[model samples]
Target: MRFALLATTMLAGSALLASCATKEAPVPVTPAAVVEAPAPAPEPAKPAPQLGAFGFDEAGMDKGVSPGDSFYNYANGTWAKNTPIPSDRSNYGMFTVLADLSQKRTQGILEEVKANPNSKIGVAYSTYLDTGTIESKGLAPIQPWLNQVKGLKSKAGYAALLAQADRNGVSIPFGSYVGQDDKNPEVYALNLSQSGLGMPDRDYYLSADAKQVANRAAYEKHLTNVLTLAGEPNAAARAKAILAYETEIARVHWTRVDSRDATKTYNKMTLAELTKKAPGFDFGGYFTGIGAKVDYVLVSQPSAVTGIAKLIRSTPIAVLKDQLLVRSLDRFSAVLPDAFDKENFSFYGTTLSGTPEQQARWKRATDWTAGALEDEVSKIYVAKYYPPETKAVMDEMIKNIIAAMGRRIDALEWMSPETKVKAHAKLAAFTPKIGYPDRWRDYSDLNIVSGDALGNVIRANNWAHEENVNHLGKPLQRWEWGMTPMEVNAYANFGMVEIVFPAAILQPPFFDPNADPAVNYGGIGAVIGHELSHHFDDQGAKYDASGTLTDWWTPADVAAFKARTDALVAQYDLYEPLPGMHVKGALTLGENVGDLAGLTVAYDAYRHSLGGKAAPVIGGYSGDQRFYLGWAQVWRRNFREPAMRQRILTDPHSPSEYRAAVVRNLDPWYAAFAPEAGQKLFLQPDQRVRIW
Candidate 1:
């Protein structure tokens, strides 16, 4: 499923930006039911702020820096300078801070249930933590899968094997999943897209840059390491052949920017049409293998699909089988012996992302358990850590942000009245889901054995695939959510016309109930506005209020929107995070729009919350100044050079520093700091691009 996330990071897993349209009416904005903690005794006075005296971290600021010249530095320069990205992490920021906290909390939850025989979470966690057992088993668990790959006798079996690999959660040349159709929001449809690259993007294989070239070499070495560990014959030669084969796959792959275009990617076709268009490979046998009984499928990146199919038919079966073997080995490396896990991390972590060390085994186990049994973990998470009062507070804040968006839409000068009406309708139709889902996913059928980590993961993957397949011929489950409650991220699902806030993201820096009103507005309030504005962003503008992908805008509206977004793209294009690499402005335009509009509306909401009364000065900073700082601090981050470079090519969000600099486009930000004419980020009033 495609999700317009608040931020994109490898830590959050791969969230391909796409839309999932839903037919359900807008659900009322309300807090989910929570297992409330025992009420605290009434206090005589209010509690202290969570972050600082007034919610902003004054010590983190650099007073020597001019806000206009470098607001991000002014707000977070001291913090960024002193703080180091964790040894096991590619980058560190507020998001990482919270994610670490969530991981610890999940670990605690697992500890409490590890002895419970009926708890799948317990069994999964304990089995993963059993290093001696894993070491003893060696490669025994995955030997059968390897044998299947080695047993491949002809090209005729390619489609079925690839489909089986996909179902078992192994990387393949192409992938398919069941999601709500873009055009038909009411029904679930099978979606296929190009896949198979071991690297983050096609650029890693195709780019001429020195860094990318080095990355390719490192990848091949890593492949050989895995192949040798798996006891393959002529490992080095096979690894080289596998890399050459994948480079061809990368050549046929679509660029990340083009793949993000909903209109271009959404190609509905009959089963026969798919077979005819990509005839070399057997599409029919593949669907049958996946257990997807659909009359038609939505092919994302049709050309890439066709190209990959042709490549599959032409590539040597031995090379293809070798690739599949390496993929399978690497996919389950963590559950394998220590050498395999460390080898996997050496390339993916140190070489690609520049992290010096791997995360602790227990932490990795906790994360895996939580992810494999997400809702089950979340059910306990929300009951313990999530405060019921926090959800209520978030609900009201979301409503305010939604109201703020409505005002912004009504005040748009470039949009025609016809377009404005639909914009308002869509805004009104937004379903804001706060904290957690109202309904929990049932994992009763999932079997997690105590001593079989590999088998458990495979079963869980198959179970998930079956769950997705079951969506076919059934009504859309409106209560379904894309993220678990323990995640530190939030998303705007355009197809559902809903904004989701996971329980874990609601904490210090993003949202603090004890913090000042302005800070909350600038932090989570802006986040809410960001998610809401996504429905009105460049691609999102194509979908109407009902979540149908259509052109509801007039020609003038479309042109006007593009004119502003094009300017945003150009503006971001000038930001050089690294010496030779610049931000991909077109690729990040949707998120940039979200930041610009979200911050603008959030400022408006903060002012409105004051009820026309002047905000009291705290720490000698005015209300607006504190608000802008709040927004900037939330994006405060430090990244390793390699991770920063990789994010430039693969991630949809701009660098955190650039994200914080989004304040340059706002008028209130200028008034708050009074940046001068010669300053770095001082955009002239007329030069500012504003679109809601």
Candidate 2:
């Protein structure tokens, strides 16, 4: 959900992977979770309804609760208390509603494809849906790759195998891509990073915590069980060797906090220098085999690339090959036979995410179809669901929000005039990619056959690899989007100095054409402000408006800015979402700053929207109250304990409960609903942090 630079997940979509964490599979896909809503003042309320004017229900509020005390509870307490997470989903909330809507719509499109079979969308959708064929064929499809791994001997052969896997999309050993040059944002640069780990993160392998230690044992057993299922003769020994190899690789991995820092990680390297830096690895053959046409690459983790290469040279060829085999199995088990699916899900799903059951096959297959042919799927989706008028409205709102942020920057007291000038330029240069990309990804070369699910995926990955490689030395597609149109997510591409809100998020509680100006401003306005604030966050501040990663702040201004941010960090560090664990203030600083500043700017924009007129009360609440309620509705979420714990441990954003608590930073929120002391969320005037 952070800047989705060059990393690729299962569908090869744009992603921001943990620097050296297992890129192939993170703990589970991140789920939604909370913030600002109003408390009930002493008044006879109107007839309570299940939902409000739009889909954001006013009845979700717990009237008995106080706002300054716990706005999350006051706003979403009833919803949290009543909403049950779906059995198949580890977490559920506002995002899930939009996601389900998109999924259902996509399912209909795929179902049409299933009927047509000859159409382009149909061909892509049907590829992953031929489950009966998959179940009957069992491991026959991927067996060739496994057999190839079994016979791998020379280091060149191993490198070739890894490249082939990467090209074909079942890649396990570190991930590679071509992205914007951090130093020179206009040009495309190839990148390689640390990947190919069995567990979710390096901490799982190296942490001294007892729970993590036990999870490691379970992971090993899962690997052994999987290898044994694949008929490996010495499965137990191979598992041990594979674990040791991964552990060594993990040792050199960049920590999550360090990984989030763009300045520290972006290392431009020539192909020859890269070879020397990570000696013993055959990057030449790998690049040649993969058709990666580039002289230089943006190596995300130099130590990792070289360290894994060193591990490759020191470890026996068989063990290294076996690790590939195991990782391959883990990566593809979702589309493989039922046996593979059950085994893979048992650990990654049940043990890791704590969902009790797997989603139905159709849902999985449909989601795969959505991801696999997202360009085409998005095209169809836009034509059907997204209208031109909606885009026009979103564009207008984005412009308004930008104006609000610019006004805030012009008025900042801590930032020097020089820094403020740069900030204004950066904000003015901001490009809002609302709804979808101006240019679509070309999937023309990808061969999508009805029953060849594996073939379809491999070709899709190859298509992406080729596309990235071809971008070398070419001008950047500045208007290109990282997410598909149907995705229920938004991102701030710091390197591009742009903000993207996918078509899906533009609908519902996030943005509604029919909702009052206050509601729309509170929802999508906050999103716009959040992304805008990210530009001034610790990492984004390094990059100037032109998208170049250069310092634009005076030393004194930067120090003053950090001093304020440090207060924000310390405030969050005190939040205990789970017992015995605390939010990592340093890690989530950027996102926290985003939430805090975003809300502040959104509120300002809301008043600006009034054009100096009094805001009309709607739904028995005043305009300011409605604004806070709408903002809180944007974050409504419920998660299982396991998912909650996982999010706290790995996610850069604070927990949903804490995200809602971000209101404590703003004085206006306290003033709108005056709160006395002894409330759960009350903070002294000095305790509040202001960064904008």
Candidate 3:
């Protein structure tokens, strides 16, 4: 199963360049140096502010369009029209902008570190950039692993090979990971779920849409290319067999919506029970091969596991080995020869996502190094770029949001007093981790060879797997974070009962320190609220304040919550991003809840911050109007058609335009914009749905 975290779902981008200038040695004699006294050092140039005068980008707004008709366009129409998505990107916006800035900063850091021979990050990065070495090495580094697959004698021997694949970061029939046990949040547990599909989601395999059909064909061709490059005979036939095998797995896979349900998906069983439930597969051998010592495991999708295990038993041994080989080649394509990298990207990037070009090699190398040594890079990133004052401001904002949520909960008429008490307890218990983790992850034991790029990658994967396996039978590491400090995203981990904000997300449209109070509130302030509200959203509500999966809501509370959420789903289902593609309301319900509740509470918090005084108008716009605009501008994104279609099918968040339209559900928005009854986004007062 996926990690129990609700993220903002924003795409992260890369950054600019930095260089160090060397100063010539000063003259030994002062008299000789005085021959040309340097002009008074020029006053340092002031850095330009990221946004407009008060944080809102007024120039980006299209005032000709009424806020009611289309608030997103009214706020960001001009910017969207002028800002072309980068050729290497499928979509671009504020998140991408900030991500680019973060990556650029990271690039500078890597460059400095690369000069140090002992720096693991430097050695790893430099090795990845050595295209000549990579080309010369070819498949020599991974040949042993491929040969191991070829040496498999029977279906029973596949368990060990699959375990080795997991360590090397390759896809397998079943995916497993260590996580906080939902029912027992204090102890880590092993989780098993259905996997093996090459596409982003099961929909990609099952959907009969013309685009999906074309994607499947492209994927098959990509597979053939990879197999042929690996010197495998009958590559075309093997590719066809692999696709057929995956399609069978897809038929039994759980839908994203169903898999996300905390109550329905949690099925804990002993080793004996698992073997019995899925009799054909080698459960014991697989667990032992991975060195997992747990007596029991959490089965995310019980029926899917059974179905997949059966398929593993029924599929030909040759076909299974072929699938593993293709997956392995794709996984290490970056460190492999250029042909492997290009073919892998040709399908996954151009065909699946519509990105025209690959990101620069150095940028890709920087990303890989950061991911491989997340904390090492993050520790440096935080020290060089993140300031103490930013975290302090964010801390205060999170507290205010939590207080505002408390007030909202107290005022809820649908919730019973008993349930409200629990809600308050949960709110009070939320652990807001801002900027970075309290302690850094140690990577001293992980080896990084200077010239062996593939070897470094493989070792890093194995080290990470060992780290996760070591977590079993130990207490949860509360200081650990899922995101690095350089990532331009945030998440709410339900099991940990915490909301984490990385250092990189605290700039520009998200949370500029110099921006207006309203803008900050709508930007990061609302983001804080969004993550907090996730704990009370449809699926998250199943977990209690203790971070244990259980029913904490009363019967009446469930009914009322569902009634409101059902209306939200209906509202989103009507949104058509493409000609035939509409938002998956049921799949995206939780995020929609977060957007609605987050914005609503953020508005209340903004009003409260003013101490009941009327907000002053700025630049011919009221504070409420600016607040809404801030929310809209942050979601200003333009997506390529193919990418947009893929997101509609798989992503849990609604399209950016519809997400901005969430303002229509709030009563204050109606007062601020006075959207007429006939406008496209106008909602009747009673038609609005509010739940937090």
RMSD vs true structure, all candidates? 15.3, 17.9, 12.5
Compute the lDDT of residue 427 as modeled in candidate 2: 89
Query: lDDT score, residue 397, model 1?
Result: 82
- Summarize candidate 1's per-residue lDDT along 162-242 as a digit string, tens digits: 889988999988878899899988889999999989999999999999999999999999999999888877999999998
- lDDT string, candidate 3, 276-376, tens digits: 99978998888888889998999999999999999998999999999999999999999999999999989889998899999999999999999999999
CA error at residue 496 for candidate 2, angstroms = 2.1
TM-score of structure candidate 2 = 0.90
TM-score of each: 0.93, 0.90, 0.93
Model 2, global lDDT: 0.82
Clash pairs (backbone) in predicted model 2: 35-660
690: Cα error in model 2, Å: 0.3
Candidate 3 at residue 368, lDDT?
95
Task: Say which prediction, candidate 2 or candidate 3, comes out ahead on TM-score.
Answer: 3
Question: How much lDDT does each candidate structure score?
Answer: 0.90, 0.82, 0.90
